[model samples]
Target: MADTEVQFMDPLASHSVVPSGQQKQVRGEREPDRTESLQNTGQGEVEELLLSSSAVVAQAPPCGDRAACSCLGARWMERSLESMELQLQLLTSKADDLHNWVASGQDHFEREALAEAVSRFLYNCQPYFNHLEYLRSHKSQHTLLPLDSYTWLVDFSQQLCDRLEQLVLTYASYNLLCLDETKPNSVSPFCMGQSQLGPLRVAAFRYFKPMPYLAQVHTGLYKRMRWNVARLREEQREEGKNERVGDTEYYFLCYEDIPNADAGGDGNAVRTWSIGKWVQVTPGTDDIYDWIMCEVPQADYRRLLFLGSDEPSSSSATVRLQQMLSSHQTAE
Candidate 1:
């Protein structure tokens, strides 16, 4: 497959290709339409939905120590929830808009434009998911920290959890649109597939471009992969410091087939890696100041990590698998 460029969706931008009249029609209110730009429409809807969603999150019972969780206060929770909820709203709205566009039917160019927009919108949500999981795990551990220091922790986590649920729903809707034959222009980076090795879902990582390698991994296999960490230290470099950073280790979450030992040893099996799980690997070190490591449980479908090279370099990533295979050879 050719390399695909990952586009970032600027929630704050006001650009939209939809005709002005259609934009007004979608808003459904006359009053001269305050949100003149489609970007604004997306941003505005996100803001409104996030506020409503945050209220729902706030009402839910608190998870960590309320005293230590400063962000959980009614007002602060609402404020902190803005960024995440806005992104979720923007993506979902984009999906909805694209669906309507397909339903209305359009020229080939218009369909291509809509497909690109959907791809970008869906890809951008991954980082927010990673950041949210990092926040949740850290806040849960810092129950002793004073509220003033991390005022937004509790609220951030709560709103993140809520928005994540919304993301799953929105992703499903978007995927369906891709699969819908009626919407001749629908497209996505992922597809549903199953085989004897087990069900496997794949996503291409733009940062690790052109990683054209493939292998079948069996279940119960543990492997560690390493990749060079990119760093920018102009100030340190100016002061005679080396800017190069060493590679770090992260475990790969591979999908394996599980035999149906429960079915009277019939030898039937199923794959266990749940879809829609958050799956990015990040390694933090004492040298890195802003790094956030996540400790979310791997067992939950929501916490599931994705396999996309799972590291920066394709060749280096295969080292662990090589070791596993070599060991197996010796044992045999």
Candidate 2:
């Protein structure tokens, strides 16, 4: 499995978080205040709200035998096989829309306009994240897409982001001992890394939505701890030498809910991803001036994040995402 071919996927595209066991941790400290959400609005609550079942109650025992674990996993895979096909169909339809939108007219003109179009399309699509009215409180939908699935998608992101933020606060409390806690403990500094990274979480399952398509994305955060360009490259390079790479090495969970293909290409086969959130497929995704001038509600994504390396500019990143997504559609 270590030598399994890596599919071309967007780190920002919607995806699965790393598995619970294999996840790598960034900090070993503790922070309580940040964990309030996890205490109140935790995975158990979220699962109950969505699955109408408690993950604790539903969780299977760690089988005594690997063959047994594999057997159970295989059964789960068989059940999801059909859902995966449905997800594939939805992807094709969305890709078709993108192609037509581009080919329809030169009139959509600005990247801003295209971004708006993408937003409109998503709203109509019923993206996830609808709030439950079981309690007396529920906030109105804010910056994320207005679609139902997109809403859940945002909720998914929000929950994970909140989890990570809490982790940061918690870890900040620790002197950096490397927390290795029980299930409830989660990896510190960023629990999302432990809870939401990896393709086993990412590529292995298909998303499902009962309202629209039979299946959608099955799979698929956070500030602070910024690293400078030269420093980051050097750090990452050093980590590589030691056979260590990105923490949690979990880029799949944050995959933008777009096609697996992006705008640029190294000519490898493209892999379609699950539903994504806040896609940066168009330029000006980070254009502060354009957003201000257009009167778009500033997303808390309001702050600019400069993740560009010498290899690609932020705009190129978006374009490359588009190209890769397009290529994936073609390949499919």
Candidate 3:
């Protein structure tokens, strides 16, 4: 495939195309605009809030005794909670704005604006997760930290995941629309299977350039949250706790062509959509960051569809077969 250029124009400047392959080389040129966007949107506000919260935690009355330490921890928890609530309010407003923009009729320029908005929101969410992880790590020190705070954090993380999923679906929908708009009348190699292309395939083709970057950002956020949740689950299991602390599930839509399950003479490839759930099998190992998407059962897929969900599920048999084939590939 030919290289695609993703260009974002400043309202004050002329049109310029930034080649995706050469983005790093042109980073300096793009930095100014990104910095400007951050400033306009109050980008570092979350980090500032978190820093102030940490300051409060640090300035807690000297822990000269057990009672004093406990009191200090209680103060820290209260300050952290207050800071998190304020950060959540800020993020929720940004999320709402992004949703409104997506709902409205957007042209190319508006689409760029949407992408910028998403990038900014994701940037803010990163620090929020980091702060949450920090708090989790120090849970032992802060005896006053309520169990309910952990639950609230998990729910809030899932809420952010929901928003990211919506963004993915919106981009995929636009990709499909772009494909239709750019389709050719001639039956060339590039156009042969255009109509049959799924959202994943369309995204792979970079039909809409921002789709790939945004999808990647979405994946990174999901992986970080999943990793944290996996650790929580492991701790619960080790302690023999029946009540699960953070039970969060994330899935991505996938499409594949597979042979018919029915007994037939000429087996043909049938196009199907499937949901692949993201799993972090090794939380503390060298591969801790290596997350995989395992195909879910057909029943779950049907249930999701019945519930009016945008993502479709995958065929487990097909996915397994693909994995087996992949395992045998020779290393370069």
On TM-score, the candidate that comes out on top is 3
Give lDDT for model 2. 0.27
lDDT of 3 at 118: 52
Count of backbone clashes, every candidate in sequence? 3, 56, 5
TM-score of 3: 0.43
Report the error of model 1 at residue 140, Å.
2.6
Off by over 4 Å in 2: 1-47, 53-152, 176-326, 329-332
Residue-pair clash count for candidate 3: 5
- Candidate 3 residue-wise lDDT, 175-198, digit = tens: 412222123211011100100011
Q: Which stretches of candidate 3 lie over 4 Å from their true place?
A: 1-44, 60-64, 176-332
- Per residue, candidate 2 scores C-alpha lDDT tens digits across 86-203 of 3323433443544344444433223223333332222222111111111001112122212243233234334433332333333223322223222233232221111101111111
Indicate the residue-level lDDT of 14 in model 3: 20
* lDDT, candidate 2, at 92: 39
> Please, what are the lDDT tens digits per residue for candidate 1 over residues 245-288?
33221223234456777888887776543112222323232333
Q: lDDT per model, in order?
A: 0.35, 0.27, 0.39
